[model samples]
Target: MQRFRYRFDLTSLHFWIVIIIAIISQALKAASVVVPSSNCYVLDNSSRIVDFGSDLVVRFCKDVESRSQTGYVDFGRFDRFNHFVAGSGQVDFVQGFYNGDLVKCEHSYDKLGRTAQVNIICGTCPNGQCKVGVGCICNVTYESTCRVFVELAIQCEKPGPRVFKGFTVGFHPRTWEIVYDGMTQLGFERSHQEFSFATEQTHVYLYMTAIASLSTLVQKPIVKTFPDIGLEVRLSGSGAAGKPPTTLSPTALVVDWRCEKARDTPYEVNITIPVEGYEPIQFTLTKMCEFTQTQDGDATRGWAIFGVLSCIFIILSALFCCGGFIYKTRVQRQHGIDALPGMTILSACLETVSGAGQGYTRAEDINSAFANEASWERPVSAQGTRRQSERKYGAI
Candidate 1:
């Protein structure tokens, strides 16, 4: 009986190289993580208070005749000087001397609070009656002249008039204008008064407030309106308008107000800031909430990195295979085996088996050949004897 044996070359460097490359490919595929974030939009720039005015108007009374303790006297028409009054159902007015001339003023009432008011009466006594036994009567029409002047010296604080979370405000250095972010400007109004000034016979007191419009930054259009959110704004400076004297201080002033409710349609906020010695300012801010946000890794970059690694690995694998083949071929050549061109390792192995079979000789076949040699020698000797006997018989 013949025994068969087989051996595996587990120690081959080429075998282990292939296993290492496969493990590396898997590790690169499992590397990324997910993250979260919010979406937002910002106001492009700050809103500035370019120009402002206190609308002033003056009205004078004429055709005056009165009876005094000096008895009945006729005084020709003369203008009456009176102080400007505001917030009074009576005409808003101011009294002062301009250029050494007494100036009595009254302004048209603005629902927006843009002007001051003063009242004046003018007319004549009915039927020239200078006295209703004592008092005088007039049936005259009133006349008013309007004038305007600009005033400055105003400052507003954070979360002004209206406050909202995540909202911030600032001032521009160059323009000294109000700056804000994450909000949009809508419009403004001016209607609060601060103080009065007397200059060279001209008595001037400004009654005005500034308003600005703004809204929150919205990335997309709202499908529907949300509930209203309330906010507050507080302001304080050297001369703040529309505030009580008790509330006025050198320090900051705060006022709380509700933000216009959020809605599908846009809404405007009107801010009213008063001026005393500085430029008046006003603007509107709108709040909008309608958009989605998400956070994630850069998928493209991650995949690109992974792909690059995979390509490198593939190239390395090719190089390793090539190096192993070359090494094997060289070793086979050194051992005097003919290495065929373009022959793979498997083909070389099959050829080696075929050659081994052709070179194999059985021990039994060799012993049988040696046993047949003696029989082959007897045939030659017998042939020679028969030839000699045939020669003798022919001689007899």
Candidate 2:
């Protein structure tokens, strides 16, 4: 079989070029997964209770005198009013309004306890005996048109700045007549079945259901805000549906807000639904602008380090291969083999088999032997012999 020679030159510029190209391509491919503009922000203090309010009421009562068998009785009491108190424990004021002839308000705290309770009482009391004495009687009346005002406090757990895009509010289908008193006061206007407004506050409330029921209402309300507006406000906490009266309803109402970019100023959203069977359900939401570093930045840094390390590894590996190739070639030359053009392993094996039983010698020895053989095969020409004969005759 004919033998073939092959060489592997690791030190060649072409080999290094290929290795570098491969490493660079891999690094570029890894970097392509990250989008510079599409950075993600994590909600740090998620689902924290920012504010809560319950047991709100507005009373309209006047003192009146009554006659009794013993003498006259005077007592203080409420005649006409509107009031509602839902949820207990950690409840605070948000906002409220009552005016004109409206009376009687009731609500249930799905988050606090499942049990239904009368939280609000409005209107004048019926004829009743004064509690001061058995023989005494008292009468309470609402004379002039009165307005009721009830406000609750909201509590935020971790107040900080945040960035959000939009928000969504859920409501019950059956309770579509409940008006959002707090949202109305915040400058929200209702058009048809939708209510929307914007503010600079970061804390809001959602009110739903005057009583607890087995059936729940889930309504989603749209939020309207300037997309370019960025607000810097504090992020307190969030509440979901169901827990204490202060907490959101688990099934009745839900709210979700998404943030795209951070804003320099904060914004607020208020919603109200006027349902038939229940009072208006009102809530408020506050958006805060937060400027915090995200994980994508850190991941980008990690990828850069990894790419650098990979390039270093590839370079070291190429150097090692090239060094080994050079050393092998030098060793072959020292042993007197023709290693300048190098041979493949197969070709070397074939050459060894063909030259088996032959004496090994240096390249110089082989060259000299060929030269001596060529000298022996050369013949003298007739002219040279004739010239030699002539010279001999002359000498004789």
Candidate 3:
């Protein structure tokens, strides 16, 4: 029988060492997963991006009215049919919407990356300290609940890893109020389904009323500006169907207005709908609240003040030049360029050029002497006298 011997090659040993080191490095990195903390009360429907791995991240949101909190974790996106469970808590599925259209969850996973399946876990933590991946919050009067607004979970079929483009979470509490008195004033027999809500960024209202058919005009976005108040509202169809109408005259209209200064100053929302051959319906959804007009007035006043100051400066400069010219010519009896108000500056500028042909240490004085004795200063008859005498001698 042949003798069998085993010897490890040096190259194989080096390769094994490198592989072992990489595995240990990844393990250590996973062991040290640090979850960042944020103020729950301040984040209103905000989201942050996170990396994908065994380690997880946590984001907290709060509702001031209910005195409750919600935590959201972005587990990237899922490609295959996989069950996700929180490491330390329970997770439940959350519903999502697209442009006010409900995105219903389906049992079939054939929607590719078009459908998103998001899971949330709600609980309470001690002293505001909570573990990552588990949706928990502290300093709440009640237990924390998982709530979301417009969160997306796309299922992509691409071969590479999917990117987690952040999502928003928190309750968008929509409140509705009946515009009964206003509708009665507008002479509408049956006007209902009109309400409004305000946020820091925008103030939105929805107005719905029955009217005659508008002949294919329901798919356009209608925008009206109230220049007097520095505000505008864009009207679109409420998505009773999956798609919202791009324009006006839809069955339902959602009015979106920008009220960035809503808290600082009051705002008014006035909506009007006209029919082809029927009485126009009007809705004064909000009380007449004046937008602060002082800013524009202040701007106008500032520009006016700047114009006055500029005019005064120009007048003073002209007066100084005229006075200097009059004083130099009349009182000092100066003539030629010296009598001009700006002659000093002009002479200093031309000093180098005028004295270039003359050899002198002080160029300005030498040029002035040459100007005083120039041939042009002599009378025309005296200037030709020397030349005429030379011609007479030559003729003799």
Q: lDDT tens digits, residues 271-357, model 3?
A: 443322322233344322233223444689999999999889766765666566556656534444444334543443344334432
lDDT of 3 at 243: 32
lDDT of 2: 0.33
Q: Arrange candidates by lDDT, descending.
A: 3, 2, 1
Question: What C-alpha lDDT, on a 0 to 100 scale, does residue 328 get in candidate 3?
Answer: 61
lDDT of 2 at 243: 29
TM-score of 3: 0.24
In candidate 1, where is summed lDDT lowest over 10 consecutive residues? 33-42
Q: Candidate 1 residues 155-230, lDDT tens each?
A: 1122111211122222211221222221222221211122111111111111211122221121111111122333
How many clashing pairs in candidate 1?
A: 54
TM agreement with the true structure for every prediction: 0.21, 0.24, 0.24
> lDDT of model 2 at residue 202?
26
For candidate 1, the per-residue lDDT at 210 reads: 19
lDDT of all predictions: 0.30, 0.33, 0.34
